[model samples]
Target chain A: MDRDQANYLFNVMRLDQGASVTLFNGRDGAWRAEVAERGKRGGALQVAEQTAPQRNPPDLWLLFAPIKKARTDFIVEKAAEMGASRILPVQTEFTNSERIRQDRLQAHAIEAAEQCGGTFVPEVADLARLDRLLSDWPEERQLMFCDEALFDRPSPLTNGDATSSGTGTPWAILIGPEGGFSDAERSRLHALPFAHPVSLGPRILRADTAAVAAMTLWQDRLGDWTAPNSDPVR
Target chain B: MDRDQANYLFNVMRLDQGASVTLFNGRDGAWRAEVAERGKRGGALQVAEQTAPQRNPPDLWLLFAPIKKARTDFIVEKAAEMGASRILPVQTEFTNSERIRQDRLQAHAIEAAEQCGGTFVPEVADLARLDRLLSDWPEERQLMFCDEALFDRPSPLTNGDATSSGTGTPWAILIGPEGGFSDAERSRLHALPFAHPVSLGPRILRADTAAVAAMTLWQDRLGDWTAPNSDPVR
Candidate 1:
């Protein structure tokens, strides 16, 4: 344990020298560890044993352009809690923020996992150009692209055609920025074979709300909400 | 229009005396109103012709215990955006907040409607005790009670028994506080004939996330998400 963790365990949490606490490194399963040495500056922990085996979320990735700082953090935290296997910050044509703090976002993901009783912590990728990411898009993975202008249009999500997103397929959900995608970007995405454009609902949702709504819809139809106990990803 | 609104248009929005703006008061449809007078302290608006017909949301009522101030505001805003006809701040035994600012929360709902292009603004009901509210519960209105402890149990929602929630029936979604409903509250609710207890998912969601998830799930199966265009409530 480092200085900050020691301070948390000793000063904040007020744990004694032999107090047991659970720990997880995202790779190993959650472990029951005991405080060996507690000090004001630093501390030591002795790993006891595994308390729970690792439970990974589905092979789902969430891609979105970074917006305001607080909302961006909200998206990452909710994505982690909602079972996104990966979080990617894409730089779109109309993306407002020019830069993002990848480390801070990753920390938010970890904190979300810790708070939500999730064993898996989704990887938060550094900001990347949307065009470049699309260029190297995986042929096997399907992308659930949320389009704002298609609000009233019929979508496979509401229609029975959502079965096209068959089971056991790797999937990703892309949410655009507050300003939404440019026309050129929209056309290119529409032309892509693997992009399944969908609408959240009839009303316009804020960017953050759109992300959550899209994830909830996808999970309901194609993700693990249908069968959480026998989740294929788990 | 009132003086404060005139001042806002003139000072904050910089709208001229003849500028036009869309207005909706949950009764009349969205109307194109003209700024008749502009002043530093007050202003007047002339009611013009209607722009769009009133589009009321479904007969979905969202009942949630007030949480932290910001999150409570968030719940109200999201309920408005996601199409709730009524928002109720219930007082459960385990509810943390002793009181709620009904006006502030109602204002948040109005702001959400303004931002989300919603023609109908949901009515935020005053805080009432859960038992008192249940005592006068509508017999025909089905309640989709979201119980956190019933996470892995077989629910009508997942078991295809949601047919119990007949079509064209009024519905309400109840989300408890951070600590969840007390055992007595759960028992009382379970004994109610109109209450259909449902689970959001396998994971334990935060109160806010649970509220949204429950709404999405209910809207998907029993609410308007099935047929958005010909939505019965709308």
Candidate 2:
């Protein structure tokens, strides 16, 4: 990809000739490139070698019931920046909106990746039925369900330890819709052997805020907690 | 506050008389109200208390560097719903907008309180300089400064032992603006005895996302995580 990609450079950022911009090809990693030529309709850039390699993203999945358009977009963008491996929008009994523009959401994820300097963009899956999703759930992966109605319980961290001391296994964070999960849905989730129902504390969080909070908890427990201890080659 | 005072309901929600709405007095607690009277110009409500005080909020403060208009509103709203006792806008070296319309942000906090069934409205403080805030920092308070540039070290939570926990003492979560904290500001924060510099993790979270994340971490370790365990009287 070069500066002639008018959509990203000219249209989005409105860069001119000799302007330095960062580019990432996912596979080729991120690059520091300069605009070599500019034209009325398009431009060209000189590509440089990689600045950072495509590294490992946390094995985190954010499964949330879709909400309003703008808030849904906000959730997707934050999920990408928070290093989720995949984003799944599920249709629960209380999900208000059934239709979602997958392409537009995917675009938001891409933009979030570009802004946050992430080489791997989280894949936004097509909306799936919540019941079907539960039926087909994998046995190996544990889920940290953010259950607001269960206000009288301690939020079980992914490590199954209250002390926040362990990195147990790969995990996913689940957030319900605006109206919250129906009792039947809650019971079904509670019955799942792999599901760990956790409270986002006593206060009810908006769906978007729940997503961020749940991710933060999981990251604190299981994700990359340390800065690179050694000196970098650069 | 009456039903007529809600601009979103009168103009956006378009609620009519006899419509059931939730009301909160910040001190008296949450109540279920019905719009008893309505006119072209205004409306009134008759409120009946339902659920008694459910959760005790933590004495946590959220001091964030304000960003754009919409996002700043979002921060205030989310902070209130997430049970922040105080919201302070601090002017840092990298703060973009010096002037903040405090009334608009306070309204957002009120609406969020009303919507989330929160009885306590977070107090919004006047914008203060970062230096002044630090110099006047309460001795017993523990400040969790979310430092974005501290990439070479693990997050403070990773090193958080029981002794360093912010329990009992009043606490504050500080989030920087989009441009991040200046070098001098970072140094000052590092030198503060009461400040604990923490990272939200490897990925770069936006200011709003960071605020939510930091609050979640603090609440989990030190706030009301056990409040949700009692049976609902209703």
Candidate 3:
């Protein structure tokens, strides 16, 4: 975070010099900061001692099919804010893009990280083929698949025993595109022993809404649901 | 509802005459529609008898402090898709907008209704003062207030009693703006007996995220969670 960056943030917030702000290095934890030196063009930040320790993020991956640009950015940003460990863009049969602007999407993720006070920026992987991604999948990791096809099944959250893995193995959520998954994709997903097809209720959800709902459900079931009295930011 | 309207929809969808589309009148439920005739500019639709009866919408109301124009539209759209019966915009101590473009927002809600195959469009209410809104609040309606003040409380979905008032009653979820609620607003919210101070979990969620999360929680607990096995447009 440089002076120009500080100024940009301050301008967005309409804050003046000497105003206290928080900063996190994703390694050293959060810090209490203030406008150290103000100038016409920019200002510097005075980072004080750490306010919160480096907390570990949950091993949650958000695997979603790429939609439109704005929506893709939205999914990435929300995924970061929701504490996803990795954001993977899977190219499905219905995925619209062959040429994704990875840098722009990555920048949006970074900005979301900066705004939401996340210590770790989710690793945004380049677009990968869904078939290849599934074929070489890590068997140990649990897949909480948000299957549009399974509206009758109860929410994955309700099945407490399903998430009882003692090792706390990594978990990921898969959300399909507007047209949803082809029969082949669904069949492959169903065949996987580790894949859990969870219902987001009866009404069809847009891909973006499904992503948020699935994250909320998972957080309630296994992630840190409780908030600390005071924010741990450095 | 008529031929001209059918043509407009067809134009947007790039459909030719006799192309099938879905129509829902809210009262008679949804219907199977087709472009019966196409003119030089517009087209006509022939709507068959109801396909699905008018399903009941939830009593949930989404009351949010409005943000940017486009995002506000997005909120209204998502709220409609998520099954809110009404959408209210309130002005808080920190609320930025004193005047809201009601008709434009209403249009957005209508379009959302059309897109999601929802028969009923959520009512978008005019801007109201937060204090006054609370003062005149209905006693029977439970307020799931998303309280930033209580960082310790788990997310509303996790903290809420799933069995409480299984009977569906009028309820509303309150979301603050980017700056969040002022101390005065927080105190007023805390003092209300009808207000249930709830969290959206450990990670700080943006206003839009909170809205979606709250709706999902309510829908999971009390609203219709049945998967739409039959066509949504009845």
Give the clashing residue pairs of candidate 3, or none.
A30-A233, A30-A234, A31-A234, A202-B226, A202-B227, A202-B228, B3-B44, B30-B234, B51-B234, B52-B234
Model 3, B1-234: lDDT tens digits are 556475567666777877887887656678888878876677777886677767646678899999888778889988988888889999988888888999989889888888766678777999998889988898888888887666666556444443375536678889998898998888888888777788777667888888888888777766666434333221
Best-matching candidate per lDDT? 1
Q: Look at candidate 3 and tell me the lDDT of residue B128.
A: 93
Query: lDDT, candidate 1, residue A132?
Result: 100
lDDT (10s digit) by residue, model 2, range A81-155 = 887888999999999989899999998998999888777788899999989988998776778888887676655
Q: Higher-lDDT candidate among 1 and 3? A: 1
- What's the true lDDT of residue A46 in model 3? 86
**Per-candidate fnat, comma-separated:** 0.33, 0.83, 0.60
Give the top-scoring candidate (DockQ).
Answer: 2
Task: Tell me how far the alpha carbon of residue B11 in candidate 1 is from the true structure, in angstroms, after superposition.
Answer: 1.6
Better of 1 and 2 by TM-score: 1
lDDT of 3 by residue, A1-234 (tens): 676575676666656778888787667778888878766666777887777776645778899998888888899988988878888999999888776777888878778877876667777899999899888988777888888777687656567645675224678899998889989899999888888888887666788988998887776666766533332222
Candidate number with greatest TM-score:
1
lDDT of 1 by residue, A14-120 (tens): 98889998898887768999989866576788999999777776788999999999889989998987888899999999998989999999999989988877778
Tens-place lDDT per residue, model 2, B94-188, is 89989999988898998887777777788899999989989988887888898887765675555654236545677888999899999999999
Q: Sorted by DockQ, highest first, which candidate order results?
A: 2, 3, 1
Candidate 2 CAPRI level: medium
User: Please, what is the whole-model Cα lDDT of each candidate in the order they appear?
Assistant: 0.82, 0.80, 0.78
Between the candidate structures 2 and 3, which one is better when assessed by lDDT? 2
